[model samples]
Target: MTAGVLSPRARPRLGFLGVGWIGRNRLEAVARSGQAELVAVSDPAEVAARAAAEAAGGCAVLPDLDALLEAGLDGLVVATPSAAHAEQAIRALRRGVAVFCQKPLARDAAEAARVVAAAREADRLLGVDLSYRFVRGVPELRRLVQAGELGRIYAVELAFHNAYGPDKPWFYDARLSGGGCVMDLAIHLVDLALWTLGFPAVRHVESRLFAGGAPARGRSGPVEDYAAATLTLDGGAAVRLACSWKLPAGQDCVIEAAFYGTGGGAALRNVGGSFFDFTVDRFRGTARERLAGPPDAWGGRAAVGWAAALAEGARFDPAVEGVVAVHEALDRIYGA
Candidate 1:
């Protein structure tokens, strides 16, 4: 095994798994950071893995996680199937490797909790792709809420509607995806609401699921096309979230999260239905103020943050325990 490329400043040696678009995008961010060395990559698609390896300027292409782990990596970045995340990440963590995985880190609450527990037991860093938390403007919004600038945060309304559905077949398979748009999209909203509010306990939750434009049944397993849920938090604060795939929303997508407080309110809304552009604003009585607008490249922020944290020798963050809560809330929504 090569001497792992821990940065001169204590950066970690990193490996990329499943180098598809999302995976490569994160690789690019990690490369730009100079915080870690890209040592190995693994993907079932030879062409995709080769492309990603080329992007890394001759990084090794390992055949599987076992091979990748043998390279002596400090961490792994997983952008694989939803059904695979928990198992893969657990395996890596068991080997004392940190992990940064795309959202829904597991098929459901139990699986997600197990992954978190593995990291906790291994004394390693673990992160999910809840990328929206790293939005440049959102931190400021959170600061405002913390400072009471938003007064008492009484309610939150979040939405994520995509006109385009997943091209992958696994997305529609209940057992594979865990759930449809809810797990894939609304997870971001749930993470956003809880993180912003300091992760309050969910007091109650009610949800509706649909598939093929009709109410879902127990046999749906993990299949769901649309999901809408209302959660009441411990403080009596309320959160409303709706997410759907292939909606006739007249735009490519509609994404927004708004917070309402006793004193004022604020929201981050997408522009031109573009997934990549967003505007944040503060609203009062009758006037609106902008907090942040487009030109913000935020997608890879979460992965980059994880890479940076791994570089610093971060252990399991107490915040990771929040993943447990998030999943518990998700379970409630699914009536599991």
Candidate 2:
């Protein structure tokens, strides 16, 4: 879809950058939503960019960010590797272009803060693809907790384990991908817990990092494949997190989040170790309540939400400050 096909006010011209599998997937999501008009695509890989552009149904293919920016885009979707996220997002926001980028937004809180500042100055919407927030039952769970329906959540436990590791080598480099499976995977768990609880300041953080089965020794050494951390929040609540990659875990993946409250407790967990399927449950003593189940098409929700908001002329959302908070917590876990 292009601006010419819709009323002038109805479509927002968007650009896609780094059209890898994830990027292309989000592109398809936005396109299918019919909320935004995709105008151009850019990627360093010629074959990948061409394929993505073609799949976008005749959207123009630009060779680089400069060309894409010059195409008069209303927003940019960034799916580049971790190292380039902060710089690319800053540039797009400074150019008055809204951005929806993959998670980490940056390697640390400092970089994330800079990107958020750029969005604030430009008065443009900035979003990070912390896609788990869009998962089934999460929003409902968050609402219940926030509304005091769950009543004074005292403790939370979150976990994400993958039997397979990343396909890229940079994922093992601390300078490039930030940290190991923690940043690439567990960051989602950390973000989900803090965000679910309204982002109370983490008063204390203690962590253990491991490579294979051994503990991490030095900061400059290789990244850890396994990690566990405990967070003590200022609101008198505590959170525990555990995540890993290629963990000899019997399942393809294991994901779960549970919150314990004075009055009741709620939990969400994947079914059959499938990355895409999950079920949410609420508990009263030994009795249980099922709130949600599988077949939830949620992976595309973040991209679609950004596209819909952009179409509505949404400005910078202060909720993006939560992105900064999530990054800060990860920084503490990494001892950065």
Candidate 3:
């Protein structure tokens, strides 16, 4: 389907598959866009589902994926567990429903590729919540890099450190959550670096994983709480990433992505240890220029964009290939 084919009066009917805090937040954002109609919500937690449904003005609280799909949805918003993301998204796509899923789209690159194939075969729209790319500072930095203003990018440094770990039990399970800090947090950092650099092919990756402050080895072991990896991209551009949970970093969180190029450098750093507040700056010879700052309100923009695109009859976007690239990078980092 093409954007021009949709009638202005027609709104896409969307189903929320997991209405937890993140799920409900995204649902409310899409609702506020007024481009998609919330028709059904399904979550194992009845209270969460009820809250989501109430927020959607009494949308039906369905039992599961089967019921939500049967509710005649044009798209499905998947906020389920990592292990279930691929199967759930593929099922919705096979049913001719568009999908907007939370990140780590699948456990690995192979799973992510399968989901992308399903979307292509079904001719349905597919979007993943790589939300950091929607931040105000991100686009400004991307524009500079893409416009050749940054020159030949040589090295990139990305970090995401959180003082508190996930509250969910599944996050600690290797099989269920994939990895730990790498999959949960560094995924965004990887995406931001490679994405801003225009999805450069990652030629090699080396990583060290730590669980409970001890080296984590082997594939089927406990998920790591801290991880550091270096990705060597095609053309010799290097990217370094480090992420951790509950680390005593002297702050609630620390998030930054810095790119160094031949001509200049640019970086997006969190302000006052805030996850949502960010500041972007371009550097040259010890001089800096601010490009963007806080008060951005970028948290749910990715969800809103997906909802709006679905309403416009947008179909499978080729750019989803970037998502697969990210998964491949993660697989390399995990040595999977």
Best model per TM-score: 3
For all predicted structures, in order, the TM-scores are 0.96, 0.96, 0.96
Query: In candidate 2, what are the lDDT values of residues 1-336, reduced to their tens digit?
Result: 111222334788899999998999999999898888889999989899889888888899998888878888888999999999999998888888889999889988899999999999988889889998898888988988888888899999989999999999888888898889888998888888888898889899998988978887424588888889898999789898999999878989999899999989998899999999989888899999988888998888999998888887788899999988888888888782
Q: For model 1, which pairs clash?
A: 7-11, 174-222, 174-223
Model 2 sits at a Cα RMSD from the real structure of 2.6
lDDT of 1 by residue, 281-303 (tens): 99998899988988998988888
lDDT of each: 0.87, 0.87, 0.90
Choose 1 or 2, whichever is better by lDDT.
2
Total clashing residue pairs per candidate? 3, 0, 0
Question: How far does residue 11 in candidate 3 sit from its true spot (Å)?
Answer: 1.1
Q: How far is 136's C-alpha from truth in model 1 (Å)? A: 2.0
- Which stretches in model 1 have alpha-carbon errors above 4 Å? 1-8, 218-222
Sorted on lDDT, best first, the list reads 3, 2, 1
Top-lDDT structure, candidate number: 3
